[model samples]
Target: MTLDLSALPPRRGRLAARPPAVPPGPPGAPGLRRLGLDPERDGLVLLPDGPGPFPLVVMLHGAGGVADGAVRLIAAAAERHGAAILAPESRDPRSWDLVRGGRCGPDVAFLDRALAATFAWLPVRAERIALAGFSDGGSYALSLGLANGDLFAAVLAFSPGFVAPPDYVGSPLVVVTHGSEDAVLPVTSCGRRVAASLDHAGYRLAYHEFAGGHVVPPDLADAALAAFLAD
Candidate 1:
C-alpha cells in the first residue's frame, strides 16, 4: 500500500504507519525478494527459513552503497538468529536525505513505505523492530531511529559519523560500533562524539571501539544483532 504522507504528522522526520493488527495472510516465501516499491531504486527483503513472527531489522546503506550489499553484512547473523531484513535504497544517489539536507525528507517517506510494505508481506514481531546501517547509512539510522523511536525498538550504527535528528521521540536502545583508525570519519571526532552526546542525552547506549578502519567486523555485527534481539 502506498503511504499517505498527509496522514503522517507534519514533523520533519516522523513516520505515520504502524504494524497492522491483522496483516494479510500468506507471507512471502523464505529468501530474498525485491520490494518493487520504486522502479529505479527498489529495496530488498530477506526472510528466514521458517514460519515465524520473526524479529525485523531495517538496514540502510552507506554513501554510494546499495541495498544488496547492505543486506549481506548481517545476512548470516540474521539467518542464525531467525530475523528478517529490510534493506531500503536511499532516494538520493549519494546518501540519505538526512545526511544531505540536515533533515529527513524523501528518504524518510520512502522508508515508511518500505516498512509498511514489509510489515504487510512478512510475519514480523511488532516489538522486535530495529534500525541499523553502515557509515553514512549508520548516521542516518541513528538520526531516524531517534526521531522514530516509537517504531524502532533499537538502533545499531556501524561507524556512523554523527547524529542529527530533526526531532527526538521515544527512547530506543542504541548500539554503536566504530574503528579506532577510521580514516574517512575519525573515531574521536565522530563515533566518540556521537556516543558522548547520546549518553549525555540520557539514552541507553552501547559503544564499542575496535582497532581497524571504516568497516563492520563480522563478530561485532553478530553481537549487535544479538543485543538487538535479546529479551
Candidate 2:
C-alpha cells in the first residue's frame, strides 16, 4: 500500500502537537529559530545554515538519554554531511515505552507537529526528509517510519534494538547497524531480531554488524553505514 505524504492524518482525532523551545543561540547572535511543529511537545531547533529547500534529517536520541551529548554528536555528523537536522528531545530521560504497552507519553502527535513545523519554517524539501536515531531514538525512527512510511524517504538506525507496532505497511528504505559484541542491548536479540522482522516483511533493508559494542563507530562508512544511507 503506497502512502500519501501530502497529508498527515491526526491519530485518534488529535491535532499535531507543538514543538519544544528552540535552544538559544549565543545570546543575540543569529541562530536557529524555535520552530514549533506541535506546541511544547515535539519540535526541533531550526539551525538554518546555507539555503532553502535542503534535505531535512530528523534525529531521535537514545534511551535514558537527554537531548545532550548523544543528540549533539549525531546532529554534528549530519551537518558535516551537508544535511539539516531536527533533534527531538524525548519526554522521559529513560525510555520511549509508554508505561509498558500503553500509549501515554513522548506524545507521538508532537513528533508529527515537529516535522510539519520544520517543513513550514525551514527551507527543506518535503519529500527528501530522512529519519535517523540512536538507541531509543532509533527505535522511535523504526516505529514511526513504519507507521508513517511516506513521510520519510530513508531510515538510519544506530544501535537500535526494538520497535513495537507489529505491522508495518509503508516500506521506507531502512539501514540498521549494530555491534556484534554489544552487551548493553544484546545485539543477537535486539538488533538482529528487528532486522529479521524487517527482512521477513520483504522491505528494502541494509543490516550491518561492527566489531565494537554499544557505541557509534566513528568510521561508519567503512562498515557500510554510508552505503546504506547513500542507497
The models' CA-based lDDT, in order, is: 0.89, 0.62
**Candidate 1 least-lDDT 10 residues:** 1-10
Misplaced by over 4 Å in model 2 are 1-43, 46-48, 98-106, 221-229
Model 1 scores a TM of 0.95
lDDT digits (tens) for residues 1-231 of candidate 2: 623322654453232422223421222222444554435334445454555455666777777664444446455455555566776665555666432344533446456556655554556555566777777777777776676666677777788878664345567788888999998878999899999998997888888888888877756622333443465
Q: In candidate 2, residue 130 scores what lDDT?
A: 71
Models 1 onward score TM values of 0.95, 0.76
lDDT (10s digit) by residue, model 1, range 7-109: 5643768887677886556575788999988998889999887767889999999998999999999898898889999999998789998888786778887
Residue 48 of candidate 2: its Cα lDDT? 42
